[model samples]
Structure formats: C-alpha cells, structure tokens
Target: MPLQKTLLALEALDSAYVNGESVKQLFGAYPRVTVDVMTVQGEKGSTDFVKVVVPGSEGKRSGGQAPTMGIVGRLGGIGARPSRIGLVSDADGAVAAIAAALKLADMQTKGDTMKGDVIVTTHICPDAPTLPHEPVDFMDSPVDILQMNEHEVLPEMEAILSIDTTKGNRVINHKGIAISPTVKEGYILRVSEDLLRIMEMTTGQLPVTFPVTMQDITPYGNDLYHINSILQPAVATHAPVVGVAVTAQSAVPGCGTGASHEVDIASAVRFAVETAKEFTAGICSFYNESEYDRILGLYGSMRVLQTAGAQTTPAV
Candidate 1:
C-alpha cells in the first residue's frame, strides 16, 4: 500500500529545514533512480527544485522509444511558516508526488520497473509566504508560476499528471481524489475513459472528476481566478495534462495547518502510480488522436488560450 510511502514523505516534509539534499538521500538505495536538486530564486524567496527520474526498461532514457510521463507534485509551498505552523494543506500535492516517486523507486528495486520513464518534480520549501484569496488564504511559493513551469515542465514529458491539493474550493466536494479532463494545448477534452477505469479499479469507487475552465487552463499571473495551481503545468507544455486532486468534503485553506489527511494523499499517490504504469506501457490513452485531429481539422487550432490574451489590462 502507499500508506508507508505517504508517511515517509510526510515525515520528510514536516520539517523546518527540509530541502532537496535531504530528499535526495531518501532515494540513494535505488540506483536506477537519479535525483537532482537545484535551487531557484524568485522575487519573494528561494526553494530547491527536486527532480527524480526513474528510468524504465523500455523507456526513452534507456535508449528505447517508449513515451515519458511526468508526474508533478504541483503546489505553492509545503508550509507558510512564521505566519503559520506545521505542514499545511498545500503540502499534500508534494507529499503525494514524492510518495509516488518513492513507491516507484521501491518497485524498481524489486524488479517491477515499467516500460516507460517517469519524471517526478516538486519543490521543497518549509517556510513560504502566504497570499490573500477569496474563500481562504493561499500558501505563496518562493518562486512564481513562470519559474515553476520553467523548472518543472520539462520537454521530455509527453504527458503530465499534475497533482495538487484542490481542497480550497467549494466546486469539488469529494473526500478522496478526483481527476480532471484531459487538457491539451488549450482544449478541455473529455475525461479519459481509461483513466476512469483505472481510478475505479484502484479506489473501488466511482471516479470523481473536477471541472476546468478556459481561464483555469491558462498560465498563472494572468489575474484570472483559478481553481488552484493543479492545471498550471498545462500552460507550459503541449502535452496532454490531467490533474489528480486530493480533495475534501468541505473547503480548506491552502495554508491551513494540520489539514493534510494521510489517507486522502495516499489515495492520490496510488492513482498517480497506477496512471504512470498504464501511461508508460502505452496501454492508456489520454485522448483519442483521431478525434483530436478531427477537431483540429474542423475548428482549427485553439493554441491562443495557452497564452495570456492580447493585452487589455495587466494581471495584478
């Protein structure tokens, strides 16, 4: 089960001094996994971007042509210290992403490597600033969205599973994990049935899906209201992106303390791990290529939505 991995990630992140080096050490035992840590500075502060690469047997890293899947633990920060204490709700995405990486590393050690490579990226920030928002405050990241996309959204990733704690909104009222529709370029395609089947098989419950708007899929810093940063990766790459959301029955602030639920985070971890397995093996399809081609041929391209539209007013 992912319980152990989730616990391990939670323990690693619930620290005032947690950084990329400390996180890298956790994967030293798995030689097949390579971990890198780079410090990125933003206007407000700095944080370490921790990237974990688990090369699969037939994956591109090994000279094979198997597709690569990116699993990004998208979040503002793990903690909003000085102003708040302890691991906040925003930490769930990082926890889930790291936990999934740990689990994949362990599987590799046990001769359970998949067919494609998995690239996992997340930041380590113990103390970050908090920002004012509508229903609840957000845990501001040390780096802004552009910086985050530059570091996390690597071109090698053909498709991405962007996991984030989506409990800060009233739109999605679920207790476990929910998935979003396939977002590619600028179109909000239908939810992948294969993903739904996998989610049902993994959780043994109905697959829960959250909504996404045109503005939500666009890049951040656009002054538009987003459900959260769950879909930020979509704006940075042409890859088909899906959001794995750790949810709650009620709204919770991103900076709220002691609001992280291990079970819920574990659920997201499991979902991501399963998706990685299927996606890498070419057994899962995020969207039908022929159907997508038909749409493009009929209506033309919708790439404009990926950018901040022709300037009318600056984003505040």
Candidate 2:
C-alpha cells in the first residue's frame, strides 16, 4: 500500500479501536486525553542530551562535611535532526496500527535515506499522576515549588545547580532554562490546548507553530521542558533487517509513574531510529565504492518511489 494510504488505514484502525461509547464520551468531554503519533525521518548517530546541576557552597570551607558526589542533579534534553516522521493518537489501538505501518514502511524502504531501515516512534505522557490527570501535560511547565534553607537558598533546588569540584573550591554548575518574556502561563496553556486539538485530527498533522522558542536551556527555568523535548531514535529489527526506529524529545524529571511509561516508549523509539540510520549509512558507504553509479541509481529510484507515494523506508 502507498505510505499515505497505509497511514490512513492505520488511523482508521485506531479510530475503530477507540470508537466505543465510553471512549467516545471520554474524547467528547476531554479530547486532550487521546494519544497522538509524531514521526521524524530516521537519522544515524542521534543521541539523547542530558544536563545536570549539583549543589554546594561556592566558597570551599576548609573544615566541613565532605561534599557529596554522585548525580546531585540531573536534567534531560531532546536531540534530533530537523527531518523526521511522526503520528499521534490517544487510542492505543491507533498507536499500534500507526506503529505497525511505520515499521513496515521502514522495512520496505531501508536504504532509501542515510538512515537504514528504521522507524522512530515517540509517545508523550504526563510527568506526575498526583499533580494532574491529564496526559497531554507532558509538554507543560509546572509551577516549581520553592523550598528554602536557613540561608534562604532553595534547600532542594537541585534542578538548577550542581557541584563539580569537591576538595578545595566548590565548582558550581549552572545551566539555564530560557524563558520567553512575551509568553505567559496563559499562553502556554493555550498552546497545549491547540496541540490537543491537532491530536484529534489526522495522522500527518504537523504543529503549525512551535511555541517553545529555543532548543537550549536559558538562564531561567522557562526552557526546561523545551530542552527536554529533544527526540532520539530507537532501533527495532528482526535478525539482519531492522524493523522500527523510535525517537522523541527529552522527558521531564520527577514525574509520576504513569508519565514514566510514556518516557520509556519515547526513549525506545529514539534508540531504534538512531541505530537504523547509523547502520544504513555504514552499509551504503561500504558498498558505494564497488557499486558506484549503481548505488546512486538505487538512491535516486528510492527518492522517486517516496515522491510517487511508495511506502519508502527510512534511510539507514
């Protein structure tokens, strides 16, 4: 089947699975509760970026309890190239079908791109169950509670500060999460609502505008969630042939259990896509010398297929 057709079919399957009265009612009342698929073109050597901050006094006290080591503070960020494929759905069944179709398409078009046969999949979920029942809040920035110590410094404000050197001088590591001056809490909520609306639509829907400004963290915590949104590719295959590649943005920290499941799924997809892209690139490079024009011809043919509606797999 054509790639577009396959996607439509998968979407139909998802709709059917979610069509029960209970699900319909739930969706009608709270459409944001649904799951959505987001896909990106598979690429090789993709990685998940993590930034950490440890806490300690800036001045080294000659006599004090030795500073504690080990990940005092850790934060994750998403890392991905500009090109990718994705789908979104609240229905687990639609997600499954979309995943299957993506897997099949990757299998069929393995060598078409620089990434080998790979389909990167990611699912966004909430960070904590106790905070809210909404699943789409995965993209939201929660109000951080400030806990101060005797010195008035946030006691466990471990999210922003890290200590590197312990012996003489304390090396404080500070990474900023950029916040937009114009965007307010209300604006953020509206963006989330817009995303929910898009999620209810078809599979290939792309966000008209990305609300998050910078991909990197800034001086404040505003960009924390944005940085964490980086997506990595996951690799899944049978035997010698890679089956699926999953990729997604970085996940939030200290979220509840339900949100963790979504993080795992997204991580798995990122790994798959990265693996496939790397493997394919290596294979193509190795064989290019012998095949020469022939390899180029194959690539051209695949491009045409992709353009002509063939279910082209991702490039390895």
Candidate 3:
C-alpha cells in the first residue's frame, strides 16, 4: 500500500473506533501489516505570484488615445508554498506511521540504553509567542518574547511525551490524554518548568539555553498558533501509544480543514488499543532475540501490572 493510503487506512480505523465500531469491522478487508510513505507540503512562502497592473486602468480601454493600460502594480500571490518529504515506517506499522509523520515534521530524535532498555526520545521546538509583551521588571530585553522561546526544549519534549503518552493510553490506559488547562484558543502550548525537569531526568541531557530564532508574533491578539500546527502529529503518535498528554493550548480547527483533532478521550483510548494491536503485529514481523527477550521481560512481571493497577486505583 502507498504510505498515503496506509495513513488513510489508519485514520479510517481510528475513525471507526471513535464511532463505536470494532477494529475487525474497520480493518477486516485490509492486510495485517502494510508500509507506506506520504509526502506533505511543509512550510512554504506565499503562493500568490505578484501580478503587475497599470496605474490608471481599472478595465480595458477601447481605442484609448494613449496606450492600453490596466492598473499595473505588484500584488501578493493567491496561495502559499509548502514543504514536502518522504516518511518511512519504524517499529510497528502504527508506530511507523506515527514516527514517519513526526520525522517528516522535522522532529529530533535521541535514544539511550537505560537499565538495558532502549529509550527513544523525539523532540521538536514549537514556536510560541506571548502577546502584549509583558515586561520583566529590571530586564533590558523584551522579557515576554525572550521567555517564549527560552524553554523551547521543554515544550518540544512535552509534545513528544504527549504523543507518547497518548499513544500509550491507547494501548495501556485506554484513555485519551487530556489537554492542559493553561492553553487557550489560538495559542500554542508553551513549555513549562515541570516538563523541562522531566525531560532532563529522562534523557540525562544537560540543560541548554533555548534558541532565539523561533519567536514569532502571536497569531491572534492574545493566543499563539504554532503549537496548533503540531496537533496532528501529536494525535497521530498518540494513536498507537497508551496515553497522551496535551496542553490546553493545542487548538483543533473546525472540520473544514479536512483534519479532525477533537477526539473524545474514551474513543481515543479505544483507538489506541486497536492501534497497539496493529503495532504489536508489525513489531512481531521483524523481531530479534534481544527485542523478544526485552518484551518478554517487560511483560513477564505480573507484579508490574498489579503495581500499575494499584498506582492508578482510586483510594478507597
């Protein structure tokens, strides 16, 4: 199957699950595992080519004493240019699909062996800006704008984990990740200190200063928009994981865009389960001794499951 078709199938499968349909009912006609690639037009400049118009003429002048003239001036084009790329599948097909999309989006990847387990981490710097430029007392720079990108790494990590958590919820928790309440419409999710701390602990990477290039004007008067751009990939990644964590700022535009981001938590959880099943099947195809042994060890401990249950159980 083509990658686009595979993605469409996965998306359809997700939709079916959301609509209260079973996985068998949705994917019964499709092959068990498939790999495909999709190309998306990424960021592009204005598409509308400049059209020159003459200064004096609004309409065609017939038999004019002078020369033919119809207001001539440079005007911005009608459409915007976009980025394009090929994406590959990684682990399970769904994971592959999710990973492919993230990779296409230019997200960064890092992995390390921790306690003999390979922990893969993906990161992306999201653009977010605070409006009205609140001043930091005693600061010389634009404090609000400065703070916006100062913790870029943190939000990127959150987005990565949010994707991971959402995917995990689909497989394990059977719940959709909740959006953080701090975000509002038009504004993208911002990195918080807590998220940064988590990433530092997980990857054992030293804290680096955030870059300055990512700052941008807030789209709406009060809210930012770059975080919203990542919603699709975030949800896509979460589709295969057990659970996802989303900040309140990630906005899902209306249905007109042909993309759906607003998903019911319960339905998202179910989709994650089905997605996990597909992922497991894909992973099984290329299994190795180490991978098998690790998976076995991970699942072998009933104590772990029980402990997890206990941890999540509400206190009586």
Candidate 4:
C-alpha cells in the first residue's frame, strides 16, 4: 500500500530544516532512479526544486519512443516557517509527489519497470510566504508562477498530473481527493474517462471532480480570482493537464498548521502512482485528440488566454 511511503515522506518533509539533499537520501539505494536538486533564488526567498526521474525500459533516455508522464507537486511551500511551525496544509502536494516518486523507485528496484519515463517535480521550502484569500489564506511560493512552470513543466511531458492542496476554497467539499477536467492550450476539456475509471478503481467510490473556470486556467497575476493554483500548470504547457486535488470537507487555509491528513495524502499518492503506471503503459489517454482538433477547427485557438491580455482603460 502507499501508506508506508506516504508516512515516510511526511516524516522526511515535516521538519524545520528539510532540504533537497535530505530528501535525496530516500532514493540513494535505488540505482536506476535519478534525482536532481537545484537551489533557485527568488525575490521573496529561495527554494530547492527537486526533480526525480524513474526511467522506463523504453523511455526517451534510452532512445525509445514511448511518451513521458509528468507529476508536478504544485504548492507554494511545505511550511510557512516563522509564522507557522511544522508542515502546513499546502504541504500535501509536495508530500504526495515525493511519496509517489519513492514508490515508483521502489517498484523499479523490484523489477517492475514502466514503458515510459515518469518525471516528478516539486519544490522544497520549509519557509514560504502566505497570501490573503476569501475563505482562507493561501501559501504563496517563493517564486512566481512563471518560474514554477519553467522548473516543473517540461516539453517532454505529453501529459501532466498536477497535485495540490485544494482545501482553501469552498468550491469542492470532498474530504479525500478530486480530479479536474482535462485542460490544454487554454481550453477546459471534458473529464477524462480513463482517469475516471482509474479513480473509481482506486477510491472504490464514484469519481469526484472539481470545477475549472476560465480564470482558473489563466495565468496568475491576471487580477482575477482563482479557486487555487491547482490548474496553473495548464497555462504553461500545450500538454493536457489534470489536477489531483487533496481536499477537505471545509475550507482549510493553505497556511493552516496541523491540517495535513496522512491518509488523504496517501490516497492522492495512490491515484498518482496508478495513473503514472497506466498512462506510461499506453493504457490510458488524457483527452480525445480528434475531438480536440474538431473543436479547434470550429473555434479559433484560445492560446491568448495563456498570456496576460492588454489592460482595458479604468472606468471613469
């Protein structure tokens, strides 16, 4: 089960001094897995961007043609530092991502390799800023959204699963996990059937989905309200992006301490690992390419939404 790894990741990350190198120790035993960590400085602060790659037998690293799947732990920070102690609610995203990578690495060591490469990217920051929001506060990142996309979203990724703590809003009230509709090139596509099937099998219940608005898919700093940063990756890549939300029944502030639930985080990790397995094996698809093409043919590209539009004049 994913519980062991999930708990292990929680312990590893729920600290006042956790860094990338400390996290790298978890994968040291696995020879096949590669972990890269970089310290990037931002105006507000600095954080470590950690990338873990569990390569498949036929992945591009070995000159194979199978597609690459990306898992992005989308979060502002694992902890709010001086303002807050220990891991906060927003840390669920990073914990889930790290746990998934650890589980995949372990599976590979046991001779269970994938058909395509799986790249997991997330930042490590014990201290991050918090932002004021409607229902609750949000954990602001050390870097802006653009830098996050540049570091986490890669071209090699044909599809992406963005995992984030979406509990700071009243939009969705599920207590475990939820998925979003497929979003690509600024268009909010339909819920992916393949993903739904996987979620049902994993959760043993009806698949839970959250709403995605035009503003949510648009880049941050657009002077608009966003449910959360869960789908912000959609603004950065042409690849189809889906959000795997670790949620709550009530609005929990992203910066709230002692709000992280290990069981819920483990569930998200399980879904992420399963999706990575099936997606890389070519058994799952994110969207219907032909249908997307047909819609694009009728309506022009919505890519303009990916950028900050021209400012309208202030009302008199």
Candidate 4: where is the Cα deviation over 4 Å?
314-316
Q: Provide the TM-score for each candidate, comma-separated.
A: 0.98, 0.21, 0.19, 0.98
Please list the Cα RMSD from the true structure of every candidate, rounded to 1 decimal place.
1.8, 24.2, 25.2, 1.0
| Sort order, TM-score high to low | 4, 1, 2, 3
Better of 1 and 3 by TM-score: 1
Candidate 1, residues 109-203, lDDT tens digits: the string is: 78899999999999989888998887878889988898999989999999999999988888998899999999998989999999999999989
Candidate 4, residue 260: how far the Cα is off, in Å: 0.9
- The candidate maximizing lDDT is 4
Model 1 CA lDDT for position 216: 91
lDDT of 3 at 86: 14
Question: All models: lDDT?
Answer: 0.92, 0.22, 0.22, 0.94
Clashes of each: 0, 71, 36, 0
Across 1-316, the per-residue lDDT of candidate 2 in tens digits comes to: 2234334433432321222232223223222123222211112221111111111222012232322111111111011112111222111212322333243344334433322222222221212121221222221212221110111112221111111101110111111111111121111112222222322232233322222332211212232332222110000100111111112133222221121223223222222223233333332111123343454455432222111133457599
Model 4 per-residue lDDT tens digits across residues 41-104: 9988999999999999889989998889999999999999999998999999999999999999
Cα deviation of 66 in candidate 2 (Å)? 47
Instruction: For candidate 1, give the lDDT.
Output: 0.92
Judged by lDDT against the true structure, how good is candidate 2?
Answer: 0.22
Error of 4 at 67 (Å): 1.2
| Model 1 TM-score (2 dp) | 0.98
